[model samples]
Target: MSHPDTLIAEDLLLLLMDDEKGRLSASSQAQPLLGGALLVQLALDGAVEVEETNSRWRPAKVEARQVAGTDPDPLLAGAWETVAQKPRSAQDLVSRLGKGVREQLQDRLVAKGMLERRQTRVLGLFPSTVWPAADRQHEQQVRQRLQDCLVAGAAPDARTAALVALLAAVDQAHKVVDRGALSTGEVKRRAKAISEGAWAAKAVRDAVAASQAAITAAVMASTAATVSAGS
Candidate 1:
């Protein structure tokens, strides 16, 4: 496969630093102090040229160093394991592993060439070649099922299940898109619409709330620990 044109952004580049098990992660955010839309547009257009900019955005490059330990998140490790085996849909992976882990895994994997993403229609039809034969077949099956379920306007439970299944297929296709494994954009386009369903919206909301709670607890615990130590 061809290397994806780098999309340089003013935002820091999230590099995937993998451990021995191929469980990927990023140690620190590589803040892009320069290049913004110019970089993104170049990447979107598949241009691989690297244009140098001012040093303001460039942080001192840290020498190559080894990580002595594994990532704190086991879900992240597991997600990499799944993606390494084959391209997967972000939607499907998220259904199994929560949205946070899924999104993190996608970011890491996409950086590491293990995953790709694209938007697709609700019916899951996209013209992308990144999919392996097996994954494409799976996508086709899920697409047909979703179409049938929607056409019949099945009971609420059945409709929900069908939609969920369809999302899973789309998630796998997204991995392909992120990796530049597919050339077509249809799957990505369709999946974007499907992802906005009622169930998905609720799931995203719950995940966000839980994440906020976790961060609050961590901050509180850290403050308590510091106070006790100082006293």
Candidate 2:
């Protein structure tokens, strides 16, 4: 891809970031979405594929498998190699993929003077951090592209379409766009078409489904953790 820095994960995070507030909006979904984005990126690079598994005892699970040679991008290569080391279910793999990944990516962007770090707390007690935009132009472009594709019905190339699919599957797409731009019905219709469109690979679809379950589980698990902590 000509724009290697234009990672789908970064775009999603950028769009989620509240520049004026210096906090990522809907912080709960950030890591799960980032994890999903990484997997989707690996799939798009042809370095990984996901296998479906249906079980009554658990949430949706899928196996991540390597597809080809080493990816030239170190971040991609590192994650690719980690997946190669073991066969992991989507939730387990996402846990690994997302652990500290936000910090790593943010550090890279910060080093380039593109992002700024700020600290806050969840529920006014749990300390948390946010990466606000040090440079807003690039992220604005990313958000605009998403708006054009989902609202205006413009055709996006593969990578972008994959980002939309991953975000939508996790029920986070609406968080990034201007709702007034398109009716809820139009938004859903367009997002579904892009996500399930011909440009999306079978592996991407499976990964997204698996990640959706993983995201739900993560949200529930974190909420439980918070409750248990309070108790």
Most accurate candidate by TM-score: 2
> What is the Å distance of residue 120 in model 1 from its true position?
48
lDDT of all predictions: 0.30, 0.72
Candidate 2 lDDT, 1-231, residue by residue in tens? 113765677777777767766676666666776887787787776666665556667544444454545336666666777777866777776667777777777777777677887789989999987777799888777778888888877898887787777777666676677767567777877887887777766776666667666766776787789899999
Error at 227, model 1, angstroms: 1.0
Name model 1 segments beyond 4 Å from true.
Answer: 1-200
lDDT of 1 by residue, 1-231 (tens): 111222211111221222222222221111111111121222222221222334754421111112233332343234334434543322222233332332443454455453445443444775432211212333344445444333333322322332332222223323322323333354444443343334333433222222223323333555588789999
Q: In candidate 2, which residue pairs get closer than 3 Å at backbone N, Cα or C atoms, i.e. clash? A: none
Scored by Cα lDDT, where does model 2 land? 0.72
Per-model root-mean-square deviation over C-alphas: 21.4, 3.7
Model 1 accuracy (lDDT, Cα): 0.30
Q: TM-score of each candidate? A: 0.20, 0.80
